[model samples]
Target chain A: MSSHSLATRTEKTEPAPARTRRTRNRGWKPRLAPLSILRLLILFGFGIFCLVPLIWLLLTPTKTDAAILGDFPLSFGTFDRLAAAWQHLTAYSGGILFKWMLNSVYYSAGSLVITIVTGLLAGYAMATMRFPGRKTILTLTLLSMVMPATVTVLPLFLEINAVGLTNTAASVILPASFFPFGVYLAFVYFSTSVPKELLEAARLDGCSEFRAFISVVLPIAKPLIGLLAFFSFVANWNNYFLPYVMLSDQDAYNLPVGLGALMAGSPALHPERGGSFLPITRPEVALAGLIVVIPIALLFLIFQRYLVRGILSGSVKS
Target chain B: MTTSRRAAARSSATAWAFTAPYALLLLAFGVAPAVYAIYESFTSAKNPGSLGLDSYAMVLHDFRFWPAIGNVALFMVIWIPVMVCGTILLALLLHERVGRLSSTMRLIFFLPGAVTGSAAVLLWYFMLDPQVSPFAPALHAMGLHNSIDVFTSSHLAPIFALVAFITGVGQWIVVMFGALQGIPEELIESAKLDGAGPFGTALLIKLPLIRKYVIYMMILAFAAALQIFVEPSLFYSITQSGSAWWSLNQLGFAFAFGQGDFAQAATVSVILLVLSAAAALFLVFRTDFFKTEVES
Candidate 1:
């Protein structure tokens, strides 16, 4: 049925090539050809619109508090302010900002490792093992995706506190490790894209299920696993509420919560709190924001091909 | 009979081995806390020693509780359709016009998703603040002169909701664009040749094929919208006067940690969990969302 539809589609699209050829033969230009230029212009305009704020974030760090509000939106302030901002940011609360950045790294990266391993295993199991309650498990995971993390936060906070894990990295990393979306993505990728007959063939060759998954399925699932890791890292890194409610110690604060504290406690802005805040300044806050985003941007740049392929294939199969 | 019994025992052991870790985690973290919260919701908190169904009555009967739900409901009313329609449109545009420019455009849109919640909220705060934002003149021209201060009112929750929607569009657009690109190119070309305009073809062919994805995105958005914390919370903390506009989740957080009312907080969390779980179940079982049967 799909092939018949494909054939008809091909027949309909074939006339377009012939028409273009005929127009070229007559030395005639198609009217719609100029629309491509229009499309490019519109896309470029929108691209600039999207990128300006990010550029503003990058430029904001070089300026002083006064200069940021005074200077043109895109203008770079003196370079010295960058150093000053850095020094102030690091030293503001006795080097707590750096501690927050490290905490962010520990929590996000820690969570990413567990999520990728368990998600891959669960996904592989769902794809390869025809066990009882497979459908039930998959359905439950999907349902979990729709439950708001905020709703779980209060309960989770109480649970973690009761276990004496509050204000610890486990508070953040443990919850993030169980992401159902990653499991679902992996499940869909495995079921639709990975071939089952190949696994059966491997089984006949005396390969155990675990061995076959490691040797065959793992290699095929690399793109998806990479995609999942990048996303999980980014999500955990950017996570605000979980860490906010879980940890109260400034030393335990992740970048988002730390930045929030900095903004709230900035002496210039809120004089009532005294001048003591995170050693970070506004531009330093901007710099720190840039710092947090850099790893994910690098990941996107490095894995662009795999990421796009993973997304496209995953979507279609779903 | 002995062999069959041994095999049954072996299989059961394997099942337990395979499932034990997840089950333990789920029970310890997921199910137990949720169930406890539900129990807490029904119990009274007036006396430290006594616990019965009074907390639920107090929470449900409270004037603030209903408005908090109303604030979130209003947020969803504006947020869901705009995000769904806007993302689909952006995706269609990107898919139809493929080139260096389009790819660059795609990356540009996706960049916002890279911004951590703090930065996104901070940037939007600066943009919406009348004194600091470059867009202030334009906002004033549109009669939104006190735009930044709007966060204080319950009426302006929708505006705060709108900012959240705009900031979040980048990721959803990427998801929708991925789905759009997956539609066999031939299907689109055929529709074009049949004298279908771009909009017409998108509405009839591409949209229908991608309807499931659209629904999934909506469900995800709806779930996330209910969790609107960082934006509204930041706005409230910064302004320090919008406590009345707190969503149930925010209120719960405040009760537990901020106000030191653990029991009340647990009660609120329980209600949110039940509602979200119901929504999740509907999507999973009632809809054909996660079905992989046709693939094989």
Candidate 2:
């Protein structure tokens, strides 16, 4: 339960039953016992449970619009149909989906950098320095982490509108850049990972506290910085409610809001919305949905270990 | 000592300087919104000084508010326990000695989790679509004749809860699996040596050991369920019930965007904010998060 164990992606499973250790043992490999069969069956069942829908989703764009409903759920259609889906998706509102992707990257990446910088500075200070309002700030930051996002979206909308910053990318990026979770993560990482003696050593060598943090602290804080950056990017990239409320211009939306628009605008989904004339079919929406998800899927596949580690360490204790 | 005092003052100054950015951001975005929520919740849009608790009262009496609360309440009451049990069961299965196979299963289980709130809802919508759904036959089997019938008002409670539970459980499983992996190999070995079977060992020892983590997921789950918006919004095809199927968040958002009712939105948000604060305070106190790292 220590943070060290939590950091590892795979826990080296200890050999079960000491008898299984030696190849020279006369004992045969254990038979497929009833329990083992049951376990494997259950595992297979769970596997199908989680994967089928996702596979079904990925296959959607391959089918023609009519086939999307007529074909069996798991059936595959031609690549020619997939091309059609892609073409229509790209043509929607002169390729608005691409802009949403760009905006998502823009907002999340900007927020990620800001969150990391502010979080590192604040976390390092909270953990290592004696600021006057340190305790109060720490308390509030933790409180903010748990507050449901909707609670803030209302007033944040009002505040941004008050300054006439609404409908701009900053309206989304600026609010998101203030990441309480990132700040808290940085605090925990510094507290656990960076020894106070290291900072003290720098101070004794005539280094200023701020200078030491930049010169010494940040150098060794790469793992934490990477973790915080990843978390911030994911949180902001996937953010829906903030940008949904803040941005009025469809051109400024991030992936989530835009995907919501794409889904709702589908001619098949809502005939009442008057988008039936547009080339927005069920298949096109599916393709656009895939476009929004593919990057996140790739990120999870590559850095799943860190993502899992980050979530567990932040949520649970030893 | 005088020079040291100056040095100390300067060090404190640096600390303040370091924290100032986040502190200001937190104030402007966090505390300000919350303070504004309280302010706006008491006043009407027409007049700022009307100091009547109309919004809060209206929040209570809003026909949509009560059903929205009921919808979420029903979902939480069922979904949290089912999700907890399902996640624990999966963690325990993955805990067994099935080396690479278990890891592969873990990977597969974790993939669905990467799909976030709005996307997950949309993906599931296609899966549950009557004509397109693989579950079409299953829906028919349940005496639910069509896809529309499946997403009908009476069925909204179960359908929304099912979507949340199915999609949300994977992340929690991965989290609990991490906690389960933290259990020492010797504990399971000793239980086996004592002639305890797998069930007894998992039931009596492993589950109890990870009970704190379960409760942790539960608290997080409770907070998450209370904020259910993205799924419910996607599920809100026909808003005849207006706010009936809407979670607190959907209701709040609708008030602001759909109706131009900022006061009502702020009122609901303040209520949710209070609930969130209570959960957060409980989490901080229950765990070792607040103590000095050295002590932990």
Top lDDT hit = 2
TM-score, candidate 1, first chain? 0.82
Off by over 4 Å in 2: A13-32, A270-275, B45-47, B238-245, B287-296
State the weakest 10-residue window (summed lDDT) of model 1 chain A.
A1-10
Best by TM-score: 2
Task: For candidate 2, write residues B212-260 as lDDT tens digits.
Answer: 8887788877888888777667667422322423788888887888888
In the predicted model 1, the residue pairs found to clash are A88-A279, A89-A279, A89-A280, A92-A279, B43-B52, B44-B52
lDDT score, candidate 1: 0.70
> Alpha-carbon error at A105 in model 2, in Å?
1.4
Per-residue lDDT for B172-259 in model 1, tens only? 7766765665577678778867887656887899899889888877777777778777777776666664573478888787677666
Q: Write the per-residue lDDT of candidate 1 for residues A1-318, one digit (tens) a residue.
A: 122233234335544544554455346436656664676676666667667777887788898877777778778887798888888777777888779889989998898888887788777677556556666666666666557656677888877888899888888888878777677677766765677788889878988666877898889887678878877887788889999988888889998898888776664333344565344545776776677777776776676654455444333343
Q: Which model scores highest in DockQ?
A: 2
Clashing pairs counted in every model: 6, 0
Interface RMSD, one decimal, each candidate: 4.5, 2.9
